[model samples]
Target: MKKIFENTQIAFALKSNNQLQLSYFLFKVMNSKLLVQLGTKILLLTLKLHLPVQNIIRKTIFSQFCGGVNEEDCLKVVDTLFTKEVSSVLDYAVEGKINEEEFDIAFVKTLKIIEFAKERQAIPFAVFKPTSFGRISLYEKITAKKILRDAEQEEWNRVVNRFDLVCQAAHQKDVPVLIDAEESWMQTAVDSLVLEMMRKYNTEKVIVYNTLQMYRYDRMEYLKKINQEAKQGAFYIGIKLVRGAYMEKENERAEENNYPSPICASKSETDENYNTALQYITENLEFFSLFAGTHNEISTYYLMELMQKKNIVANDFRIWFGQLYGMSDTISFNLAANGYNVAKYIPFGPVKEVIPYLIRRAQENTAVAGQTSRELEMIKKERSRRKQE
Candidate 1:
């Protein structure tokens, strides 16, 4: 009997034993301590923004993990990814910006990205975070108390303006804009913002997508409600699901604040909801497009199974797969090899601006059970084979 999770194209991509020797070498650098330390200094320089280091970082880590600094810069990478049959979910990697000017810049930049996608006919989608256009204090206030202050209201409105620009651009260009989910404290605001865009722009089609962090126990119910609302309003539903990203921060917050953590109590619970969300979206994939953004082999396999079980085509426009650019080449490359629609979530920005993400990538690799070690072993194995041959 075939294991449902072991037979899909994605599974083959992830678990294949015959990858090029160079494959493991790439993974090793992403997981290496030397690289991590070097990345730290580069990050500090980036934070101070010497600005000259941008090119070096761009040439190295950013080149490896991100698409490019701007739309035109992204085209070559986009074309390369397309040739390999992987799409590009282009995200501008400007994190930690906090001011009105910054917000305005972010909004304009996003609209341009949408227009750029349209012109290329190459980029399927783009994404954004609320913090890119508003203050954390405003979001946290709305999340914790479910209300806002007058000044906060002004900021919120600015955030809305930002969304309006981007969503309008996406609608005009006929591309979907994915509003990324955030930590629990601020997700209420983020969700509300995404809902507004969906209500306005999604009536004709899924021009906007709100991420569902399935690691949260409450999200499945929320997913159901959102779809119900979509049906009532006669709008298309768009979704992307992922196991939570801020596990440690969420747990620490709960410990510090004396509240129950919002993250799944265990990985098993998280995985269960993940599959449920996959099933939910597939059930409606005829009108809705969904992306599974994960590096988990089993989740990808189960989604492939669901497609087949429901008689959906592996190449259906309604379904897609994505992973961070550097971390899951095995899963990503293999999916491309097998003719499925997959993407690399290529983030590019100034090095300092993106260090936090880079560090998290390093830490995530180190923390995943045996991931770092397995990656290291593979690199060594391949390196040895190369030396002798």
Candidate 2:
């Protein structure tokens, strides 16, 4: 098969020159670690102080990375991706709320998104973070094997009930709901809840998908165990595999608390582990639904090769690829153009509420060596190509 990711024309088809130039400037600023760190702190403080910075943020990083402030605001983004044969996974980007009422509101927002997904063919999945619906302290307690107080027990029940409500809505709508993975300290509870939902709704097909962050050293074993449970229980398991996003925080916490780090020793180890999990899931495709959520070219190409070797059809719903909105368009769009199943994780929320998510994206881009440079190079290449044409 021909290499599809290098075609810049398809990659940037929706980006106007002005938008491309803005991205170039943003990535250039993000390339400087000091600038990203300083900018992130200043932006967060300004947003907190109710300053008049939303307009610039709305135009720059937020517009580049997020879908919109609400579902209606995301329609243009959904339609543009649909035109390119790509699909969207609507993710409400609000996070870190500790109030029960806030959790209930997030649950209701999730149901609304599911109803929206049911009506829109362009939206392939609805996604939510487990922490968004549950208390982080409760999750940490569960992970630490601690007993909960009666009040805490009631809170946990509320969390479980919220998850059930959202999953039930998705089940009724015939839309798969993705449960995003968080830090390892709180992941066990998330894992257990996702499994419960899968057992309930995934008897025939995978309606509740659990994400596995392959950067963890023990995840391959976890994947094996989950696959066994799914097979024995006669239920299909949905797995979305990613390299993980909390490497720094995870390591820092482990060091501060004097625990062995759960992360893989190196990027190469994570890559090996991720590829192994992908191969195992694909080999047992009958019992698992695989979503390769990645931006790494090698991992993406490895998946394509695995599909070819396994004889998985190009358009198989059992296998799909995903990239985040505003990043990795070269992979997302070109793969969709080549008839591969692909979707983008399109996040949306009020500009101020979503600043943390946007800042994290910027920081990650800064930390990843050559990431912003690569994006800049590709944008420049496309612009030059267009000018020549």
Candidate 3:
């Protein structure tokens, strides 16, 4: 409400002059739609051809967006952020693995993160994408209510076990785990599985968080339904509310297949839906814990205002503000400086395996109107502020 996010000094407090310049340069590049499109294509091609591009990537965009190559590599970032009263959610950024071995690797990696979170106050949450533990086609099949073959059922059972193991570790460690949302076609099955985890591990408190992509038009109804279920079952619900990440793919697939798009009609409608969900969660804090995840300043302020109106303390345990690491330092750091709970999602993995996630980050900056420019403006302001000092 007081325009707190404008404090560029606090926003860039942890960044060195070099880091600020690097961020500026990166955002300047990201601001060009044509460049981002061409860059992503070239990077993907380079990776596929097994070209020697890792060093170049490691020095540039990878350093800008990712934490490190593994969990231990992320500790420096986790500690540095906590120096500003901001916490870290260690997110394993590897994607597109379809084999049993890879799934097991993700499962084991997640469990390890939970253990790490258990020992560190700086790390608050552990996260995993649902498809990281299983195949997308399998999830799509189950979402469509198609019967699974015996072998597929066995594979699905392993997927469920992976989820349970992570949730159970989180419960034991007193660490909350966030499950990310994927494409619409596969999300129904994921939703059902996450709800089951909530019922199982969230009896005493919110140890599991399901991501709600508020850009989907029908998520309001889903939220209401879950509210009723939580009340009936006497279990708490934890949700990380995001606007969503897969807009172009969602619309294109819907049109190609002759179904209405699940996405909201426009950005304003999506914003309205996100804010509405935020209001609903804030009003029902007794039954819900929220991690407000966004890069949008207005939405961040709206949540702050809601908390003020409700007389909720700034350090309320049931509420948090989050943004991806290497982005939105304005919101994350300034909120932390103001004594609000904040966490940055620190993604780490091998550079090659993590390219897909990095590509999405670049594409997101390109697709979201004005996001890159705003970031560039903030970095420039900080640089100018520092020079005068």
Instruction: Estimate the TM-score for candidate 2.
Output: 0.98
**Residue 75 error, candidate 3, Å:** 0.6
Least accurate 10 contiguous residues by lDDT in model 3 = 58-67
Looking at model 2, report the run of 10 residues with the lowest lDDT sum.
Answer: 367-376
Q: Give the poorly placed runs of model 3, Cα more than 4 Å off.
A: none
- Arranged by TM-score with the best first, the candidates are 3, 2, 1
Question: Residue-wise lDDT of candidate 3 within 156-240, one digit each (tens)?
Answer: 9999999999999999989999999999999999999999999999999999999999999999999999999999999999999
Query: Each model's TM-score, in the order given?
Result: 0.86, 0.98, 0.99
Q: Residue by residue across 292-324, what tens digits does model 2's lDDT show?
A: 999888888988999998888888999999999
Clash pairs for candidate 2: none
- Sort every candidate by lDDT, greatest first: 3, 2, 1
Better of 2 and 3 by lDDT: 3
lDDT for model 1 comes to 0.76
- Cα-based lDDT for every prediction: 0.76, 0.91, 0.95
lDDT of model 2 at position 363: 86
Per-residue lDDT over 287-327 for candidate 1, one digit per residue giving the tens place of the 0 to 100 score: 57797898787888888888889988878877889888755
